[model samples]
Structure formats: C-alpha cells, structure tokens
Target: MFCPKCKSEYIEGYTHCKKCDVDLVDELPEEPDEYEDAPSIDPVKIRYAPNAIDAEMAMDLLRQNNIPCFSKHSESGGYMSIYMGFSVYGEDIYVDRNNAQAALDVLNDWDIVQGALGEDPDELEEPDSPEAPDEPDESYDNAPSYTRRRTAARVFAVYFAASIILASLFGALIMLLDILLD
Candidate 1:
C-alpha cells in the first residue's frame, strides 16, 4: 500500500498514513509529463529563515494568508544533521511568483505583531493615576545616546586594561624564565 497524499509506501497491514491521516491506496497514478492545462507559476524566494523552526513559522504565516510556500535547506544541512542532530545552515522560503509580495507582506505583519503578544495580564501593574505629565523632562531626551556612549567607552577601557595586564604578566613570566635559564 501507499499514501496518495505523501506518496510513501506502507506495509500491507497499514490502512492509513499516520503522517497525513489519508487512506492508503494499492497504486498511485502516474505523474503527467507536462502540465498542459495548468497555469505556469514561477517560485520566488520570500525569506531566508535562520533555521527550520523559523522556516516553519514563516510557512504557517503564509498559509494563514492563503499563500502557498515551501522551504529549501542547504544540501549539506541534511547530511550534517545526521551526525550533529541539528544543522546550522538556514532555510529559504519560496512562494509562487504571483503571491510573493502578499507572502512578504503577511510575514512583515507577523514580525511586527509577534513581539507584542503573550504578555501576562496578572503581571501588569497600573499607574496610581492615568494623567499625563505637565512637562517632559528635557534631560531624558538625550539620556539614551549619552548613556550608550558612556557604556561603550567603559567597555573599551576594560578590554584595553585587561589586554595590557595580560601582556605585562606574559613578559614578566618570560623574564623570570630567562633569569632561571641563564
């Protein structure tokens, strides 16, 4: 027996495909050589997802918008995954050329909205009073830029100091070894 939907062969005892839940058939019809009646549609890449999970998410979003899409991963990814249990290579999602823009639009909307969901209602706190401040703090306007510059400078200083200390220690070790050897 074989599954008509997934086109996978099954044992004689199996009546339905576990993956597709479709009834098994004794034989599958031969594939047509050419699509003489079907309209021509070119596939266009819509997004390059960083992993299979991301690709699946994008495919789901496109499906919700009535856009058909498929994912293609690097050829080596499949081979490497056998040993590593995961593949680092990203997957590319493709859709019909006519629906490419619609697929992209749907993905863009999902990107924007996905981050704003799933907030815990019980964890949220309301202000004592819902009134706007009479005057905005002028100092707060430049706080982010100033804070960012200061933080970056501090990080650079720390790394520079650490490198200098490590170099001095290495030099001292070399001198002590030279003195002992001489």
Candidate 2:
C-alpha cells in the first residue's frame, strides 16, 4: 500500500501512514505534484523578526505587497507565542530569489520611516513597561543564497577522481621499485 499524503509505500500489514495518520491506498499515485508552478523551496533568509508576531506581520506585509515570503520558526512553544513575547530561536523570514530585491526595498523603507518617526515597533506595546532592546532586524536579501545539498552524484565524482589518481600512483611506484631492483 501507499500513503497518498507523503507518497511513501508500505507493506500489506500497514493500513495507514504513521506520520500523516491517513488511510493508505493499494496503489500509489502516478500524478505529478499539484504545486508545480510554486517556486522551489530553496529559501533564503531575508529578515529576522523579534518574535513570531512580528514575523507574521512581515509575512502579511510581503503578501499584501505581492511578494511570496515564508517564515522559518521554532515549532516548540509556537502556540505559546501569543502569550510569550519572544521565541528561543528567533523567527526568520524568507523570500524567493525573484522577489528578494523588491521585498528588501519595502523592508528598508519601513525601517527608515520608523526611524524618522522615532518610534520603535516594540515600544508600541506599553509606555510603562519596556523590554530589553533586541538586535536590529537585519535583512539579508542582497546575499541571495541557499544551503547546498550534498548529493550522491558529487560524492561519487570525488571518489572516482581520487581512486583513479591512487591507482596511477601505485602503478608508478611498483614500476620504479622493479627498475631499482633490476
């Protein structure tokens, strides 16, 4: 059987997918992914928000401005973000390469406008209570980078080249030894 959600195959005894908790099917799907037009998920971090709420606001801003953005947030205590003001691992917002420059321009303009108004977004919470200052919300949009995947093809290429060089060196060493002995 196969899990339709994850497209993972399972043996006859399994009737459901453990992770998805969905009923398995006798035959796997042959259809391609429905989100074919969606940009590839190789995300580059654009901005780091002080909290999930801010991160959400950033997402909303990007979406409203017609930029496709995503948030990388810690799953642990995610629900508590409403009550808790901060996250252990700060939230990072990402945008695809296509929309990065435009997204950065929007964020930078927001920063400049806020500075001109002498208003900190965090201070809007309450006048009586002030929290520790957070690191400036830095935007990495100009970098436009992704985490490189170490593929089997790359590993095989390195191993093949090393083995060829080793074999050639060993043969030369043996030939040199034979000549010296003679």
Candidate 3:
C-alpha cells in the first residue's frame, strides 16, 4: 500500500501514513475526486504555486483546517503525486466555491508567518543572494558600524586619559612624601 499523503510504502497491514497520519491508498486520487464528499458547489482556484508540491501543501493546509480543497498541476503528476509532490511549470490550488475566502485567509496567514520568519520565497530558490550582506535575521538599531566603533574608541580614550592623570597625581604625592621623609 501507499500513503496518499506522504507516499511511504507500507506492508499489508498498514492503514495510514505514519508520518502524515492520513489514510493509506493504493494510489493518489485524481484532482476531481478530491472533493467527492464535499458539498455539490463548484470548486474555484484560490492560489497558484510554482510547483505541485507547494500547491499540495496549500491544499493540505486548507483541508486540515476543514476547508475542502484540491490541486491541479499543469504538468503530469505521475507517481510523484503520491509523494506529496510533483512539478512542471506550476499548479493551481482550488477550494469549494463557498470556502474560497476561508481558504484564502488560512493560506494568507501561513504566508504572513513565513514572511515574518524571513523565509523569502526567492531565498528558497537561490539559497542566498550573492550580493546580499551576511547578517543576522534579527533586527537591531540601524546605527552604522563605524559609529559604534567611534563611540567605543572615544570611551577608551577618555579612560586612558583619566588613568594617566591619576598616575601623575600619585607620582607627585610619592615625591612629596619622600621629600618630607628626607
């Protein structure tokens, strides 16, 4: 058997995917039948992902949140559909017409969270921009590096100057004490 979600092969007694927790099926069902038990309303495209994998992820998120949805890949999905993936040019994710807005909201929230986590969609493609500076993702003060360096230098100079003056005063006191002793 094969899991319709993660496509992990299972021996005879397995009824569900151990990783995805979804029921096992001999094969991934085609797009139209995805909403077989959903209400009789038409399905509408709610999103277009760059590949079938992302499209399936969106479909899974929607269905997991109780929105009936499915995905249609522009290219042949083949056996890879059972693997929760496949790609050509792109794929369209659809939801029940009445659940379109709800599905959009859920997907939008996911996008927002990803953005906040700094997972730029382009970064996923290019790994890291060659021109981009190496920096931590966390935000801090916008002051320039030179400014901080200058501030630290100034503080050290002030401390050095104070130490020199203090040393001179101590030296003068020692000389005066020696004179009194003599």
Predictions in order: lDDT: 0.70, 0.67, 0.66
Candidate 1 lDDT, 34-75, residue by residue in tens: 867887678777666757897897898788878888988744
Sort order, TM-score high to low: 1, 2, 3
- Model 3 lowest lDDT segment of ten: 123-132
The lDDT, on a scale of 0 to 1, for candidate 1 is 0.70
Q: What tens digits encode model 2's per-residue C-alpha lDDT throughout 1-182?
A: 99999999998899989899999999876888889876575556677675677778778988989988888764443533443445544577788767777887777777667767988766542211112233432444443333111232344447878999999999999999999999
Off by over 4 Å in 1: 1-34, 118-182
For all candidates, the clash counts are: 0, 0, 0
Q: What is the Å distance of residue 100 in model 2 from its true position?
A: 1.2
Q: For this target, which candidate reaches the highest TM-score against the unseen true structure? A: 1
List TM-score per model, in order: 0.44, 0.42, 0.40
Error of 3 at 58 (Å): 1.1
- lDDT of candidate 1 at residue 32, scale 0 to 100: 84
Model 1, clash count?
Answer: 0
